[model samples]
Target: MSTATVASAPPAPRVQKRGTPLAKKRQWRAAYLFVIPFFVVFITMLIVPLFYSGYLSFFATRLVGGTSFVGFDNYVKTFTDPLFLAGVGRTGLFLLVQVPIMLGLALFFALALDSGRVRGSKVLRLLIFIPYAIPGVVATLMWGYLYGQDFGPIVQVLSALGLGSPNLLSDSNVLGSMMNIVTWEFVGYNMIIMYSALRSIPAELYEAAEIDGASQLRVAWSIKIPAIRPAILLTVIFSIIGSFQLFNEPSLLRNIAPNAISTSYTPNFYAYNLAFVSQNVNYAAAVAFILGIVIMIVSYVVQLSTQRRERLG
Candidate 1:
């Protein structure tokens, strides 16, 4: 009797599998969970501040009228301001001079390393990269001390060697000194980028070149350099951004060389002085926004030129 009852109850309904819609919904939920944090932080930290700055840039806060909308007056003033123009020109010069030297050195080092012929290449690479690991403030301070005319080690050594101590932080030479410091700091970082790109090239290309009796220089010029153009472009873009955003080094060096490094030495430095020192937040916002636009335009031009060259080639 038990066996008969068990057999009668044996028939059960089949469970249906979930549809694609349901599975997709679950996947979308997981994706949102992963991405929500980034969006939240980005909106809170960047988007909101940018919009607020843009809002501030259109208004004027004065002693008598309080805060009142002035339309594009702040922006017009920013475009015409000599201080702002000087800073822009200064940074443009910095980009032109420093970026070339830095990138050249970086490419040289990367090519040497990629050749696989340099002894203790790993050690040399690490040594080159160590400066970048140092904090910008620390690096600036370290360099500032070296550039000190009165008591710095460099000056002392020069004086001891009966060579007159040249003023590195002087008005005439300070920009070049800054360039040297920047080149020292960033060469390794750019080298690593180029080196990584070089390493990714197909080994068969090198083999083919070898079979064609190509010298190492010929192989690098024809294959490696062309292959790594994108990496070079990336480094150039980064250098351009960094050059325009040049603030920390100049700001820190101001204390060391007040006569040479002005409060408005760089666009960023000018913006900071306007906002904090002069208490002109509205104008400062406008200046900062304008500077951001300049950087975008310059970077866009560079990218466009690169693309055009690629198309032509």
Candidate 2:
């Protein structure tokens, strides 16, 4: 008699094949195809130059045959350079004072626009945002001329009134002057962003607040501000980064106020001068990297502090 034998089921299908050279090769080919352009441009423009800068930073450039390795000498020189240190300090000061004021103005304007009480709101918004639409160079040039001591109508009018116009291009007033220009350019830009966020908020919340007899101010404080906190945070982060990366306005203004604004007025300006004007590409790279790191750290700190406050509340 033959024994009854049960047929065994075939093994379950493998979802991922292991040790398959053909699959591996196909995957590699796909990856390469997907990344070819990025690698090409990145290597050509960014990666190769970055590595070269890193290598160069170890050496001091010479007017003669070749450069010699000095090992952190460039970095040491950066810290000890009074001009560099002063630029850093001035940049930090702008970030601290101007960023907050600009963001606050943006927030206030956004809230006002969102309130729906103001007639001709669209026109007002457009007018406010027009400055941002202007090219930075053009805007700076126009404002620079307007701040001119001799040619400016403002100074002329003030003189006629026997009230001396403050020298906006002076060393003491240059920072404030720059701040005003930046605020004018960016307030409406940031306001538009915050307004979009405010519009996204659910109307039901406001309706409920009104039902509870909350005033407009109370609704704004208790609901609108809290609801749009993320957008506010985003604008603050962007403003902080922009403040640190300031160059064009200061650079253009430098020509007008060379005595007050040095070749290194802002970190970006300093880096630019180092790389191009002075031909110290290595030191410029170091300073560029340092500025990037500083901005990152400050952004992170702002996020942390805001998060802590939210948690506490």
Candidate 3:
């Protein structure tokens, strides 16, 4: 019998001691080096601006007084100003209607694509996501042209069918029209978020569901939906934030639907006009702070509700 001996491995190197003053100094320096840039940018871009805006919010800038601290008078005016109030109401309406529809379509598409039953899902996903890839300006312009009252392809097509072309840019219809455009623009973005969440779910869960003879719909509702609730909530919060910050689409569409989209059509629009057009930077700052508070409150409520439900589950 041949005797075989295994070679013993060399001892591993000792980890370098970290608590020595020089070592700690090096570590601290490295940490500072890494974080300094971040602090610089944050202070310059965010902290300074936010504090300045907050400071301005407390004062009112008038032609007679120049700049005077009025102590929440600007805030009070923000709540009372008819145009600002109307903008807030319009934004709320958009949020209530558009967010649900956008998230629903995104969820449906995500679920359908994740299901093994769908064929050519890659192609479909690419097609769906193409709109998101298009620049917001370009997408709005393309849709605006298509919605044109005179000689646009859609209008011409309707005319050929002997049906009068519906004015999508009309005051009564513009809000709904904007909803459709926004949904088309963002559904795929939300879908990507949801699909990624769906993919993270364990295959073991699906296998167990199948073994229990659960149908596709049953598995989706009882397992898939619950597993992806966080992602859905994430999309909902994002939609809420985006809905309130509504600017690009409305701003671009204003040219096409000036009557439908007034200067103060949305809070963001109102703020922009106040700051730049009307030269009311102080009041604009107040309006912006008010909107920020609303956003923060809504986001906190959503997160709190989600956490409570998760604990219950």
Displacement of residue 262 (Cα, Å) in model 2 is: 0.4
lDDT of 1 by residue, 86-133 (tens): 999999999999999999999999999999999999999999988899
Q: Could you give candidate 2's per-residue lDDT for residues 76-155 as a string of tens digits? A: 78878788888888988998899899989988988999999988999999988899999898888888999998888768
TM-score of each: 0.91, 0.85, 0.89
lDDT of each: 0.92, 0.86, 0.89
Q: Write one digit per residue (lDDT tens) for candidate 3, span 96-130.
A: 99999999999999999999678999999989888
Off by over 4 Å in 1: 1-21
Q: Pick the lDDT winner.
A: 1
Quick one: ranking by lDDT, best first? 1, 3, 2
- Which structure is stronger by lDDT: 2 or 3? 3
- Where does model 2 exceed 4 Å of error? 1-48
The TM-score measured for candidate 3 stands at 0.89
Report the Cα lDDT for candidate 2: 0.86
Candidate 2 pairs with clashing backbones: none
